[model samples]
Target: MPVGRTRPAAAVFLANLVVASGLAHPAATASPYLLALAVLAYLLGLRADRAGPALVLFGACAALDLALCAVLGVGAVHWFYALSLIPAALLLPWLAGRYRQARLALVHEGWERARSLEERQRSVAEQARLRERTRIASDMHDSLGHELSLIALRAGALELSPTLTGQDRADLAVLRAAVSDAVGHLRDTIGVLREDTEGEEPTAPAVEPVEELVARTRESGVTVHLRREGPARALPPLVDRGAYRVVQESLTNAIKHAPGSTVDVGIVRRADRTEIRVTNSAPPSGSPPAGPPPAAGRAPGHRGLTGLRERVLLIGGTLHAAPREGGFEVLATLPDQVNPERVRSTGEPREESGSPASRRLAVARSGARRRFVAAFAAPVGFGLVALVSCAYLAHQLTGCVLRPADFAAARVGQDRAEVARLLPEQQFRYVPDAVRALPVPAGTVCAYYRSNGNLLDRVDVYRLCYAGSRLAAKDVLPG
Candidate 1:
């Protein structure tokens, strides 16, 4: 396995070895070589994705150390001092490493979240741009298609007039057919832009009145009756365009669906609103459809009424189209003044606050923040416990060491009672193996003490032996 992948296992193995060796010889825990190895093991554990076997191994070692020490009849203070090494050497470094790993993960997740959000925003902007382009194309198609129909109607009328020569009539027929072909091409271009999909189209502005539109249809051999009830007044551009479109579209539908029908158009301009109503009577019996059939490549389904409804609603108006008295009827009410600001505001696209992607990202960020807090809190808490324990162990261990001056003051043949006051309250439990193996005089009981109280530094040990209630010999042992 790669080094990075094997780090956790190495940490567990090395940490267990260090801890086990320290328990066998308590003084080894203080050696720089062993302490450095323990620190390295903890640093390796930081790479583990979860808490690994190191902690369990440490607990097992601690229990075994205490049990072995108990069987050997070691002092309670020595056992407690030995137990404190577990947290200071193993648990503290591991906790700190885990915290460092968590901090790095939090930062990485933040950058990823920002990148994902930016991508989603870019996608949304692209979609909105496409939709706007499609709407503009639809609007152009509606406006131009209506005007072309009017031109074709005029050409047909000229072709029927008796005053025209035979050559003139043939030219007029050609002109009308060309106009029909132009309309078909326009439809095909819009269909290609929209991929055969229908979209809401807005009406183009026109200064023509409903009366002029009706008169033009009448001249084209269609029976159209126009009635204007309200006083003549200059209307807003949107309302004027809407009124013209309502009559034009209704007439086109009557001509195509019910030929030879009598169409009635009523325009009533009130103080607050303009009302337009167009109704066509049922077709005469045996009357064929008036307009030419749809051309090749033209998409099916009529989109005129749908476009009209969208345009009317855009200007804060209402439009209704339904069948009445065996014919079609269209009723529209347009307000005199529409709020341009409101219309523009509605047209502009906005980011949706409740979108699923947005919600999911928010939740992920929240979770990352919580984990970061927890990672920091756990290490700090573990560190505090370790510090308190280490401090207590240090205090107890300091009491067990004999100062160099005290060792120097003792005499080899001094009375035991006088020398007793120079001795410390406890004996050093971490005596070196060399000192323990030294030859002792016959019938002498030997006790070991560290030369100094400093916990981290390697120092000499003093061995004092007593024989027959008198100090027989005292010597310094290297550590």
Candidate 2:
């Protein structure tokens, strides 16, 4: 039904006529219906599932064309002319059919491959998202757990027997219980939310030293003072870790708000309590606040300090973060016995699993390989077909003789059938003025047999006059 498909058949029909125009005694009067029928045959051949019918149709047209030329009193068609017509009638339709089929196969394969690649990319992205979320949750547990436990300890340490009233002791007990419950709830919630990421065991991070935290802050161009009130060699593992985080967060805040100010960091360790205080001299009052994470110019997110505060409360700690006269300070007091359970992370970094870049290379290689093979094979196939066609044509044309010797045996009186046998393998025709100039016997046919080669080859022709069942005269013409 598509116009594009029918156009080639119509074009082939017109081309067949154009090629025939250069032949001897072209059928300028070739019937329109016959030409349409030939085109229809070609189209049918193209549409047929099998090639046999199409080949038969082309062969039939070639035979019928020769018969028509003889019946029309025209000279024989040259072999080269036949060759030209064969490609128009047979080759084009055959190639078109093959192209149509191959195109369909390529389209199907392309669509299928494209869909598969799309799914793979989508899956990779989803996996990356899940992996990052799991890491974030694990990081929160490590950084915030100790802070919460300190809050409960601070509440339980208050004494109301002599110095505090009864109501104050009851409130302290309620606050301690509340902070403890919140820590358990937060851990359970994060654990349930991370269940879908994987079923892997957790990895525990190494405990960080407080001195390393101060050194990193100094490297970032912050003037910092470190003062320790007691020896810290015997600190518990969790308190040592939490003490480092408190310093890290405080120094990060200092750099963000007071880019070129001096900060004083003091750590005091005792048998019952440990205190960490970080105070930073404010920058010039008119200066815009520095690279705090919540600012638009940086990677901004919700204040993780709220979660930090929650962590401190669960571990019984008192944290005060406020702006003093011309300076900002974050102070935390933690019980020496702060121990909230540590959960390790088993989730690996996304890049460690496999690279998306490597997968992209594999996909690209497959696509390129298919296209390269197709690109190389098509031209080779067409060239070989053309070579074989030319070879077949040369062998067929070689069988004919186009010299004076082809009709040398014919005499003035010979059986017509015998004289015909002696004639060259081609149609015969009368010279233009043969009817009036040549003397021909009655009830006989007189004609000139053209023995001409294509384009560059010169050949001889012969004139013959036949009467009844015998050849009355014959003459070999000039080349």
Candidate 3:
């Protein structure tokens, strides 16, 4: 037997010993031989095949009976009759084993199902977390980056005003320099926010015209030259955005690291693909690069080539950034079919895709809607159904288990005097004491009773208040 079965078998053996001893002392008058038979039967019940052991026990008991009673052939007939118990004992282990196996199977199945459900819930939660992070990062890039860029642009223009006095010029230059630094800091922050650690779908900016994008780069003090060879065709949103960002970042880097260098920005469109190239000479000695100035709030390498490479690859594009003839060069090629509708709908200057802020907002909204729907719908529906089913089952169970007599007694008044008069002999002492112990008012009677039995049995009674021959109130005794 298994270790877990030992305790139950031992308990059954002890209980059977006590029962056999009690039966032997009573009408059975079983002898030592009969006691031996009983012990064998008890042991057999704990093992696999009880029928054989039970038959042996019956034969032993019959022989003892015959030997004591001095009867002829009577013991054999009695033993045959006693053998019927063998089949009943044989069924005990089978029934118990089946029941135990079924219960264990049910428990195992429930545990497996619960584990599966938990895993599914965890997967969904993880997806939701990723979506929320993406949305937040996109929002930060779009809103903050745009505002800082505008500040830097305005400051640059103010410094260029020719009518300013010496002090005014110096102050304007300082302010412009500060603003440029702040813009660089903002770019770094946006770059960090836009990092897609989860490998989520890329949230590229909407496509804009190549010329207009070049104009924006020029405003930021980066010299740009656009060269195109073929009929212009609308590229996919991802392709356009990827191409735009590659050129944008490349020019930004050129301005920041190679001041006074004439950067060549070129866009080539063919029948099936588009290519972009940007190259600028290294900055002049002792002159700060024209890119956004360093600032405390910006991330390191904000305008580095790494962000540009990521943008290019996100849209199925290829990028190459390296030193060429004492200057840096970035080359990229993008496919022509990414997503045309998303590109056209934004309607920003065909060349001037707004800041990353706008692109991030659109992606965040899309992801949030999808995440919210998936998060709550299925589990909440299952829980509501389970709750309703449980309530219905509880109602049915209550109806099935409640006793009709008790229910009726609650609705009707009880007669305490009748209850006391019908009390059984065994219950007479306790029933009267119980009734007298009740703090009932004078002329009112109270008694205790059972819910069901003959009148002699303790039928349920109640505290009865009668006023002028009419029943005033009744309170039934609690079970």
lDDT of each: 0.69, 0.56, 0.51
How many backbone overlaps does candidate 1 show? 0
Top candidate, metric lDDT: 1
How far does residue 409 in candidate 1 sit from its true spot (Å)? 29
User: Can you write out model 3's per-residue Cα lDDT over 1-479, one digit (the tens) per residue?
Assistant: 13225543434334334333433231243334434333333344434333354445445544443343343323322333233332223233324433343444445555655565566567757665765565465445434444444455455556667787778867866776775676566666656655453333444556567678678767766556777777887766667666766765665565545656788877888778888888888666765323444567754335445555555565556788778998888889887865443323221223213544334444445544543453345346545765785575445333223233443444223444443233333221133334445666567533333334333333444344544444445555642
Name model 2 segments beyond 4 Å from true: 1-84, 87-138, 150-172, 188-195, 198-458, 461-479
| Model 1 per-residue lDDT tens digits across residues 133-195 | 767766676667767766776676677688999999989888878877786677667666662
Best by TM-score: 1
Report the candidate with higher TM-score, 2 versus 3.
Answer: 3
Lowest summed lDDT window (length 10), candidate 1: 195-204
Displacement of residue 279 (Cα, Å) in model 2 is 38
After superposition, candidate 1 runs with Cα above 4 Å error? 1-5, 26-46, 51-85, 88-133, 157-171, 195-281, 284-289, 295-326, 329-367, 383-479
lDDT tens per residue, model 2, 187-223: 6666555634242223235566778767755654457
User: lDDT value for candidate 1?
Assistant: 0.69
